[model samples]
Target chain A: MSSPFSSLHVVDLSGSIAGNYCSRLFLDFGAQVTLAEPENGASVRHVPPFDKDRRSLAFHHLNTGKRVVDLPKSKAELADLVAGADVAIVPQGFKDEIAKLAGDRCVCVEVSAFGADGPYAGWQANEMVHQALSGMMSNNGEPGREPLYGVGNRASYAGGVAAYITAMVGLFTREDDGQGQKASVDVAETAAAMCFPYVLQYFYNGTNRRRGDQDIPAGQVLCEGTWVCIWIYPHRFAAMCKALGLSQLIDDPRFAQVADRVKNWAEMFDIIQDHVRDEDAEDVVSRLQEAQVISACAYRPSELLENPHLAARQYWDGPDAQGLPRLGAPFRLSRMPRSRVNEVTE
Target chain B: MLPFENIRVVELTTAWAGPMAGRILAHFGADVTHIESPTRTNTWRTNKGAPSPVNYPDFDPGERRWDRVFLFNSQNVNKRSLAIDLKAEGGVETVRDLVLQSDVLICNFRPGMLRRLALDYESLSKHKPEIIVAEMPAFGLEGPHSSYAALGPTMEMAAGMSAAIAYHDGKPTVTGPSYLDPIGGFNAAAAIATALYHRRKTGLGQHIEVSQVEAAMQFIGPEILHAAVEGKDTKPDGNRVAHAAPHNAFPAQGEDEWVVIAAQTDAQWQALCAEMGQAELAGDPRFADVGSRKANEDALERIIADWTGAFDKHELAAKLQSAGVIAAPVNTPHDLAHSDYLRARGFYAEITHPVAGTHPHPGLPFHLERAPGDYRRSAPAFGADNAHLLGEVLGFDSERIDAMVRSRTIADAPNKEA
Candidate 1:
């Protein structure tokens, strides 16, 4: 089968996860990506968890299938590649340069920490700061405690996802007119969108959300042995009572209405917690699932890698240099087999 | 006026994840028609007579409450609604007929539920071999946990994100709201577009599977990959970076107000020190360089916090940024909503629905200089376009459509009190 991007070429001038991952998505689409890296290679190569050969596990996962080009390429050589390519994935700072080189046939996607031309455009930030600045950290920890930042550097990946989406829209537009466009995706805005209706509600009600801000306390509940984040939607009140075997609480006036339930959430959580303290997390989730209430076991990274469902769906790309499975594309396409370039070449 | 002018998407998704993808497609100009039935009205639309948390204008959901849900209105814009009870006798055939004319199909049902509905890829492809079907399951289609149901929070837990980002020394905690749902939706939309590109070239339609769990993993890919390679458990370290000093959210003057400051470079560190009126601190050996500063991050944090505590967050952010140090106020929802830059960029779209009234909706996240995404229509009311889509687009006669509607095979509202 012909790949979606067989004729497409990409100049990946991104060093970190955001731009690299965007290029990786293009690589998966069968576009030939030439990663432009510094003389010592990209900074990601030096990140932790290296193989015996000292190759970064992170770098191997994102860059294995793409070709690497040393940076400081002669302006003419770089311009030649950009002129013929379908996409140029660059850092926010390099937007104008890439745009000039791309001419009219190549789409330029600039992924930045703030945005391309914001007051904070020249500011330095990474995942941690982006999280803090985006109100994500504000809603992460317990009340009275200093806010927490989510594990894993997601701010950058969100930027990458935004870049990918923008690139696709650009390409789709180009499909008709043969004209390319420029796209700028700010990591902060992308992170904000991930929070969804919360952001919307805040705008509607003028309330800033905080950690433990829900009507019910949300966290890992230890069932017999597993940990799970049990969602407690107001409409599922009866189902939850049945699932937790607290059916008596269903008619209690303190928990009768959504507003009342929210007001008495702390006490209600205590009652529910006391009942489930001895049960297994998986067991509790099973009961909840039976009642059509939402719940699941809290997964560790190792557990996720070994998850049977992922194996069944072929969501891993085989062992990397260190004999660890690499995460596959976030989505799967049935007819066109996954590029599987690294699995074959590595 | 958008990129996907000729594309048509038939959505069978409910709740946040799948519908969000449909929303994006619609925003970009795809003719997205949401398939619903009285039996399976989306939970977002069937808010049980209660004042939905998603209500707009801060008003009670009046008589036509189904059409007033904030979630439904926000997510279903630029899309039409067609209520077809696939559970009805002829519903499957009707959808098959519709599928034959559409370019793409999307659903987020549990893995086998679609198969049970005879709406899985194999069955749908039988009708139109060149149809792109995007399936977003909470878990992947074939995993042991595939059958397990998950909302956004649970999936975040299962993806190890909850555990990884907890309070310092606390157990794993859920982030605010259903964080991964939108991310999953965005990825699904991108995947669908990519598949459409493939179909355009090869004249083949494929089944695209997006697992919310896997999508969450991609967010923390390098960290999880590290855990796999290093065989070590990772824990949440609040606001701490491996190589940056002064890399924490510091308290400001007001309650819960904060400014995040990061001084990664020596020049930035000097700038920060100068702004704090402690330029001499730049000469201190303990915090002289990135390595030393990271080694003594605790001390650096306290010192910075002490200076930051006396100032308002907004002022501190401005002062730091002007000094060439990276800083930004921890934006509340109001701050984001009222952002001058965001407003100036036309990032908020005000869409007016008859029942829900007018409200601000987020414009497209990506800025495409040439065909920017815009709202062409407000979200449709339940089954609002059943007659138009079935009769006009699908060429179904009014007699058949009316018969289906009378049989409870279609409805504009929930068949039972939802």
Candidate 2:
């Protein structure tokens, strides 16, 4: 199972969530990872939900399975680690600190609140700033209403991960050039704009993307309790009519034909919502799934973690130190390719 | 193999962030597997994959057609499935063995579940020093509310998305689900690739953890940084901008039918005023500067709407755009798929799902050079590749695999309820 480029070493110098996750990816794929810690140990260890030993469960879960280098008060040890470092995950672009350490050899992938050279460069920011500035909140809830953020710290993670990948691109490029270069990535609140849909509409049309309708032309503006950010396409569209016991929709003028339906999609959406309201969330979803129409529950974290398919998929274990047990890679490799589980000797 | 193609990744993750991280590696051609148990299927029932209950019956295998919609099929292509009973002893070792032999191990467990299974960072490192482990949750691995439960909405709200919408002028609005999951995907992919790059340099594996809430917040930097720097609230401008005039989504003849128009320059504004047959309006002082126009958007919108009321949204959008005014129809998913530009860009690809039949879904957002990017196969069934993976990757004997399966350690189906 060894890869031809299996000789890489990745050192993760991060505190809590974002940067560490970036490094763990390298660690998982057969790369050597060195988890460095400050003299006080990981700040995450003191956060909360301590184990019986009073150690942070969340910290333990994210920081396990790696050797730790306690930074000296002299700050020289940090320099040594950076000198040997290939990629450094600095969410806020600690350029000066990283520059002194990673120096010439290392590539610094700095994740910033805005961008490196923006009007808001030196401004202090976190997840909240990023989400709001991206204009995503504009279309999130009822039209002409206040904006809402995501259910999770999705922006920080998004910036962190996007920054990490950008670092990889630098790495890939370095491979061809046989030279390493430092890259500054600005993962601001605008970073996730592409995923919001219709960038062209925004760029060319001056469209405000943050509005949601309870029942609009194409879909419903859903508010299903806690899992707030989810917009749903009902399962009973004419295409899925056969699956929803409403096969008659396939022949109905308004409901029949993808083309015709597209023309009257707004009215169609409202009509679909009328039927959807009659059914409970689960029933509507299950029925729609059966019919093969695109329908989703627009779930929240708890609902997602509690899914039977996730259970059936064995995707989670239990709540770990971080929050809840989660799924990793989504596939299975060969287990009979002479695999052996190595246990470090006591 | 060039890198991780020969490497096996055991993904014990659900939802989008974590699973998608592994899915990307799979796309790069890794043997990524998913773990499942009967009780673990409750996460994102509507958003993830499932059977279409209306057309397909739940109990009847014939009626139990698989849920292969955009979200599921988009991420899960080219992966294998395995059902595991993590509570069982042999099941624990099975994961450990899988980790030992795997090139990468990805999981999105909240914060602490790895230790209970003895597969935490410390545990796995003992088994395989160079193993990559990734973790993502509602928040980061640390914080006051790190352990709290939330989906994309809650996270977005926590990140201040509600505060930013400011459209209604007072109450906060939440951005909800729009880009939360996909943002996680993009960031997770970045993190995973960075780790891989680091490993390529160090030969050492590390633990990577991400907080979805934090990740999503980064996108709203304008407000965040502005508030931080200016100590002022960035109010919502509706569809308008701080520096532009006549910017907004104007209503059309139909409900949910609208056109977004931005006249950034004087010439653009002149063209718009001409289109309205009110060429004299552009000369008015009240609508001269962007500031003047901002103060008079209501009357301006009324004027624009009156002009727009007669034409099709798409037709008008095209006409305005052709005039060099930034404009396009605000599209729905169906409209998006059928769009001429998107079609020309090859934004959609049709493929046959093992259970869901032939359909199109949004393909890769990021592309690589010299890469043949296509959905190689539909998502694998539960334990669909158990024997094949066990035999081909782990080199297990048939008797051993059969015994393990019989023992209910590594199952092709749910070995036990969570």
Considering only chain A, what is the TM-score of each predicted structure?
0.84, 0.69
For every prediction, compared with the true complex, DockQ reads 0.54, 0.07
- Top model number, lDDT: 1
User: Fnat of each prediction?
Assistant: 0.61, 0.10
Please count the clashing residue pairs in each candidate, in the order shown: 10, 198
Write one digit per residue (lDDT tens) for candidate 1, span A78-114.
Answer: 7876777788988767777888887987899887777
Question: Taking the tens digit of each residue's C-alpha lDDT, what string does model 2 give over B3-32?
Answer: 345657888877666667776677666778
Regions of model 2 farther than 4 Å from truth:
A1-140, A143-170, A173-346, B1-7, B42-62, B65-70, B403-418
Per-residue lDDT of B147 in model 2: 50
Candidate 1 per-residue lDDT over residues B107-150, each given as its tens digit:
88888877887777898788778888888988888756677877
Q: A215-255 in candidate 2: lDDT tens per residue?
A: 44234323233212222234345445554456666677875
Count backbone clashes in candidate 1. 10
